[model samples]
Target chain A: MSFLSFLLGEKKTSASVAKDRLQLILINERRGSSAGPDFLPQLQQELVAVISKYVKINPDDIKVNLERQDSLEVLEVKIEMPQPEASA
Target chain B: MSFLSFLLGEKKTSASVAKDRLQLILINERRGSSAGPDFLPQLQQELVAVISKYVKINPDDIKVNLERQDSLEVLEVKIEMPQPEASA
Candidate 1:
């Protein structure tokens, strides 16, 4: 399945490209808003503190971003859990 | 700055809540699309292969999601570089 997928180059579908582009634009728009990049570091720390209380995580593993589409704004957070230290 | 920001509890502003809710909705909407959850593992592998060629990263560190808002669809990709092995 992987090999066929690679050879066919069907991986990059139009829908996929459009989705990426739209997300990127929204992400940038949100970042450029009044909150700005400065808000992220502090936000990240707060989120990490809150989330870590429930699940062990390195503060660095937490990522937060903003997305605005139409009248709606979205805050996206992604955390990559570190192995070995997963117990912490 | 961090202490004051924390004590005030202003971190979870209205904008932040709206953003998080919208993003969560979009992410779920995109994931629930025709592509489905099965598509993610393969997509993740493909992305890891392509991105690793340029910058060293673990496949596990990469995260991707889809968001659809009104008429627009967005694809979000987030990658976390592992430390200690950062040289790779």
Candidate 2:
């Protein structure tokens, strides 16, 4: 009966599995610890590369920050776009 | 010569077009103005609904916030997940 109960109770749903994955990803992203690599710098570099294809921009013109506030996980992406040409 | 120059200068590259679209979307998302709908609440609701499938959670347990810090646009999603059962 105990073995049967363990078998029945141990079954995990797909939703639970997804929850576990999301938790792991979010924790890794938030902590930027030894558990996993930090992805923000790569994200910033990619953003710069993509945006640079259209307009000439300095690498410093883009900023990416990941912050935690209370229970919230915030990902901020800032790109200082070039101003349009001034009309005469 | 003037008309030819205008024709040449007026052509927009796909990259520039993509930049324009991204700018518009970001602007709309950041401002939550009349130009476009705010997606944060819907995103929160959807997140709650999805997570609720695996774990029982209150609607207030999740918070979503979009904030602008200088040129940066921040999207924060916070979920207070339920604690696991204490091991015997």
Against the reference, the lDDT scores of all candidates come to: 0.36, 0.34
Q: Tens-digit lDDT track for model 1 on A1-88?
A: 2222222233545442232111111121222123323333344344345444434556565556664444334355655443342233
State candidate 1's DockQ: 0.03
- Assign candidate 1 its CAPRI class: incorrect
| Location of the lowest summed lDDT over 10 successive residues in candidate 1 chain B | B20-29
Against the true structure, whose DockQ is highest? 1
The residue-level lDDT of candidate 2 at A8 comes to 24
Model 2 compared with the native: what TM-score? 0.28
| Model 1 / residue A51 / CA error / Å | 0.9
